[model samples]
Target: MGLNSAMATVPTKEKGSDEIDFVRWFSQLEGNLAETLNGVLLRAARPVQVGAASGAQNLASTSAGRLVGWSLREATGTAPGVVRIWDGRDNGGALLACVNLGQGASETQWMAPGGVSFQHGLYVEIITGAGLSDDVEGAVYLGGAE
Candidate 1:
């Protein structure tokens, strides 16, 4: 028997597409005093929300990129603990868009197709109660396969 044949190896597969998985997280800080700190992200195909107490996540396709995971826990607070995402690249700086949730207090939608005329740098700010400050957290994710 030859000793050269005793070595073992694991085969690796290559990605068929030039796709990559990426992710980022932000947190609501301890004492974040928001009645609802929206996590707005700009998508081109409207993402989907998951679970209760949380908001829509993602429904994205790479205009030229992959759909990674999420980037959460960048803040801390009362934590509305919601994440509402959308498409068309205009969810404010908000990790998630509030408009998509639809009618927390309305019979009709606030807008059509895309809500709130999103600008290039419309910052997604928090909406907490008066005279209170706490922390909150959330994340964004990206992923695609070949």
Candidate 2:
């Protein structure tokens, strides 16, 4: 299941314990604990990294996946290139992020503490600029669900 679907609404505790409903408090705490555990497990899944290539790279084959984080470096080219991340099997889907590399070598890293879920998949690609042999190298951090 997707990260959001797998999660449940945790019960909330009372603002003040005037009445001191012990049973209700306990239930709320238990629910909170389960939610925390689920989040930890989803985020802790092994991460897969995809390298720079001519075309878009499919980081995860699973239909549903999450993007935990990613790190990339761009350099050694006539001009800077852009690193585009998408939530799909290719760049045809929704755009997650687009990092424009500096004229000189530069690096970037993106992370979602709670993780970002995608229904399609995760993809990354380097779009070179003006006869630029830009080498945009990066690794995508994938986790949750698939």
Candidate 3:
């Protein structure tokens, strides 16, 4: 069964406490706990390679949520390249983040700091400079309630 299904099996019981409804309190607590746990698990999901390109490429499109983090790796053995994350369909929109990869095989990771969130429902763009012999591979991490 799924996590939500398992969480649904939790029993709610009523308890007398002066003028308070302990059953409702417990139910709400369980729901909050489950949601928190689910968020953590979602953030821990494996990264997926959006795409690889020699020039500018549209890496991925989000589903109306804040991008929390990302991991990028240069798959080709050519010169280093720059990867930029945009907030729109093309690279002409607002720039959200950028990462510089070293020459040859190299990797890097990024995470949004506290009190910062990327725009919702936007597209991430990856761009590389000249001398790219092979395509670049990378993945992005997204979070927030959608």
Candidate number achieving the greatest TM-score relative to the actual structure: 2
Task: Please list the residue runs of candidate 2 whose C-alpha ends up more than 4 Å from where it truly belongs after superposition.
Answer: 1-45, 53-58, 131-133
CA lDDT of every candidate: 0.30, 0.61, 0.54
122, model 3: CA deviation in Å? 3.8
Candidate 1, residues 1-146, lDDT tens digits: the string is 52322333344476443432221111222112211125333333222222221563233322323223333332333333333444344443334354211112111122323333322222222233443222223333322111
Pick out the ten consecutive residues of candidate 2 with the lowest summed lDDT.
1-10
- The TM-score of candidate 3 is 0.55
Q: Residue 129 lDDT in model 2?
A: 50
Per-candidate clashes come to 73, 0, 0
Task: Enumerate residue pairs that collide in model 3.
Answer: none
Question: For every model shown, what is its TM-score relative to the native structure?
Answer: 0.24, 0.56, 0.55
Give the candidate number with the greatest lDDT.
2
Model 3 regions more than 4 Å off: 1-46, 53-59, 112-116, 132-134, 144-146
Per-residue error (Å), model 3, residue 63: 3.9
> What is the alpha-carbon lDDT of model 3 when measured against the actual structure?
0.54
